[model samples]
Target: MKPSLRPSLPLLLAAAVMLSLAMGLRQSLGLFMAPATRDLGIAVAEFTFAIAVQNLGWGLLQPFAGAAASRWGFRPVLLAGVLSYLAGLAVMALAQGGFSLLVGAGLLIGIGLACTGSGMALAVAARPVPAALRSSALGIVSAAGSVGALLAAPIGQVLAEGWGWRAGVWGFLLLGLAMIPAAWIAGRVDRVPIPALAPGESPRMAVALGRAMSHTPFLVMAGAYFVCGLQLVFLTTHLPSYLALCEQDPMLSAKALGMIGGFNVLGSLFFGWAGGRWNKGALLGGIYLVRSLVLGLYFAWAPTEASTMVFAAIMGFLWLGVAPLVSGLVVEMFGLRFQAMIQGLAFMSHQFGSFLGAFGGGVLFDLNGDYVLAWKLGVGMGLVAGAVQVAYALRGAAPPAAERPAAA
Candidate 1:
């Protein structure tokens, strides 16, 4: 890496724009699942299974993709990722059977998302920023993802309602296509010098994967991330339906979800900034603790439309706020040379949680008449996650006599 060069502001903007589009389009896929299942003759679990496959596949592929990008190049991997993303959209739009849905939406799109999602965005952020500013830059990239969700949720709803779900899929396809130029802008306009591993540096991918897997702090943090995913995705995917059952309009439900995504941008940026300035683990613990309290309070209050909206806004502020700091911790402990691979490994835990959250929530709702138990379980998990992350922070600290080298 050239110590003299700085990542231009335009490059940052370009990266953020591309990331936003990719995130918005991918996230909007869930909005179509329930409606599509009803229109097609597929079972609810079948649709849920497709999404679960998507998450599992993405998680599985992310590390490899990061490795490839690390070894070969970012531009080619990014192009390939875009193709996979678009192909997934196309197949989903035309799918006539479960096979098509699984292949298109589940395998292909999942792999595509792995290559292009937060892992890649963080990598991009790491490349340009000064070491001291890494956490803030990472947060900015993460906030871009939330911005996509903030916009995409409501837009997806409108397109699905007005133009048809298929049209919405196609619209997202067009959006994905637009990412090509942004990628070009953000990536190699010239043959940039490749970053080199330090002298005595281990092979990048192996070290990252092995180090993260072996580390106790990483394990605890990653495990807690799993719980966060379970709670967040479960609620996001099904909250609209839950609200509707409580006599709220579907549009209102969509708005609530959108609001969650919207406020999350602020939360993500806030936590990201805080991570740079303060103890990230403490901040993360506090956020999770607040989440647990909020969930319990919402349950007790018994949601009316006004109260539900208020609760949503509160929950929204905390929702996905953990992302930047969680990823930030990986960089803090491991450094950014192998950041993508390390982060991807942690993300696998996240996806596993998402799989359980998405599918399990559906199963629970189908089995029982109420989601009360699920909500309660979510609160419990939040507390546990908070404790785990706090423990990780304390345990991961360097030896008292040792000082960390500054990142250049």
Candidate 2:
């Protein structure tokens, strides 16, 4: 294969760095929920709803951003994403009310994620790489975000407490802006393989999405990933509150979260490398299965600082581990032409789940004085998600493209 058959070093680095910055910054948002809300006199439900809005916005906008990237190159769209992210962060730093937080943390941040985070980053990074190396490449990129999380989480908490949550907002804003130089690197190419199409046989993104939606396997996969989002968001958004409820040291939540980020780096890399040697979908199923068990154990034992750290380390290793597999599934079935669009559609499910996780945790905690129900539900969902993936893998058939439409 020629050199162009693979992603260039700079392209991969740029995408990885952007993803790291975006994800790490976004994950740190949870740390601010408690402090910011208390200071602003915002209700937990209201604030959680604001965070949920970000997840919802991210899901809904990802497909559009991806489709736009498919038609235009990734650079302009990515630049737009950069601007949106910076604007959102700026608003957050200055915000003292719910409405401003809604605009900053909810809407603009979601738009930024749609453009610069997983959906577009994965597409740009993988599309330029050879099939065999794509999984490893995707893993490396995903793991980069974990590294960001490792560094950003503790720092975010410190900033939030020290400068008030507003200062933490400023810190994340600066980190998000760092993606600009990376965008310049990743923007150099937006190559998508185009096969010969018969006259009047154009392959539109809508058609691809329609095909994916109509497929049972794809639907099942999406449903499974919804649980993934829910599990993650619940932990990320509400862990601080949960700790406070249990009368544990407040710093412990930050420490656990930071550990999760640190271990997640290892998990992403391991999963990425493992996908090359194992069945991708099967690996995803296994990952979810382990998640269910881990969460069950977490709930079984009383919460302790040491136990929390242990759980975080274990969970972190599995965090975002399925990203490459699930994303790879889309590319495997549909090829690279519709990579961004189809993958975005799939991630939509993840973000929707995230919304439920973040908002639901707050609602449940507010109503019941604890997070027992949320944790139980997450465990059940994880089991279901695992079974769904396994079943889909066993029933593997050709993706909708080769069967009914022009090669995408």
Candidate 3:
């Protein structure tokens, strides 16, 4: 059957809500790091280690989750993710030390994120829409995903300040309950038939994986994606601490994160529209380039409230914009049949960078008592990666031989 030209509103809404909740809660967890560590009597490095583990676990399990969704359908996988999220938050709220933190925030939430995050949610959004509208649709969902952060950051910050860090996690738990229904609604995408494969294309997942692995452009794109993970995770995990170290008001971090979430909506929409008209690969590179420049500018000077908010806005606009570009590229290069799994493979690289950003930053801070070296390293790497991505994307390479249909 030919895919519908218009998107399925119900599916899009459901996917968007699920993504929003998953991302919002996950991003805001950083706010709890300072207070939670203090109250629980753990070192900053120990707390960050759990977050590092979360990134690693999410990365490691992502491909498997995608494959499971492809085989069993999105509903079961999504529902399982919701339960895990709830359980993870519960453990986090009641935790007494690092072990509980690791099990709750690291293991369970990581497992939950693998199922509920962008890979699975975008894959669901990509179905039922025609190719022409896929990028825009994915963008819309990604924008919605930012909403959670907007609300969660401020709320978590307030609750943590007023009641305690545990209350803040409990707040997150309450927000997570909403995802159950969203998952059920998004699951409807499973009913949409997969697009018919081209002649000579194999239905097997391994074929798609191998084709992607051998594709030069895909490899380069995936490599550049590592920087995206590194830079973003560093900010999310450490920005609050960084701001606190500057002796800024506690609420400043919340405001900055909220600004990022708010601006992310506009950025996602603009990029989604642009991805349809421009080269998605080049657009991804530009976002990285601009983001690195912004990072350098913000960190070079002492942060004021005005500068911090401005930085957050700029960063937010560049944030999550990659979702549409990357998802669209995956579909354009490979096919929808294995989009989740293929994207997951690329995301593994991203997670590795995230691990470094979270754990590495914490270690650097403990060693130096400052974030100077960490930000410098992130800026340097981002510049190189972004430049390479832009240059390589302009090359306009053809799809790998395996992806092209053989002569009959």
Best by TM-score: 3
- Tens-place lDDT per residue, model 2, 1-408, is 443434367788898888888888888788888888888889888788888999999998988998998788899999899899899999988887999988999899989999998888888878667666878888888888677887778888888778788888888887777889888778876654554553443477776677778977777778888888999888888888877878898789889988998888888889988987877887888888898899989876678999999999999998978887777777766667777888888889999999999999889988998889989999998998898788778776556646333322
Model 1, 1-408: lDDT tens per residue?
A: 543224456666666777777776666576776678878888666777787888888888888887787777777777788789889989999998778988888888888888777777667667766766767777776776677766777777888899888888877787678778777766662244434544444554675566668777778778887877787777666776676667766677667777776777788788878888887877877787888888788776556777777877888788756777876777666665666788888888888988887777777777786687778888899898988788667665651111123123
Question: Model 3, stretches more than 4 Å misplaced?
Answer: 1-7, 401-408
TM-score of each: 0.90, 0.94, 0.97
The order by descending TM-score is 3, 2, 1
**All models: lDDT?**
0.74, 0.83, 0.91
Q: Candidate 3, residues 221-294: lDDT per residue as tens digits?
A: 99999999999999999999999999999999999999999999999999998999999899999999999999
Prediction 1 global C-alpha lDDT: 0.74
Using TM-score as the yardstick, the better of models 2 and 3 is 3
| Steric clash pairs (candidate 1) | none
lDDT for residue 140 in candidate 3, whole number 0-100? 92
Candidate 2: segments with Cα more than 4 A from true spot: 1-7, 191-202, 401-408
Worst lDDT window (10 residues) for model 1? 399-408
Clash pairs, model 3 backbone: none
Clashing residue pairs for model 2: none
* Displacement of the residue 310 alpha carbon in candidate 1, Å: 2.6
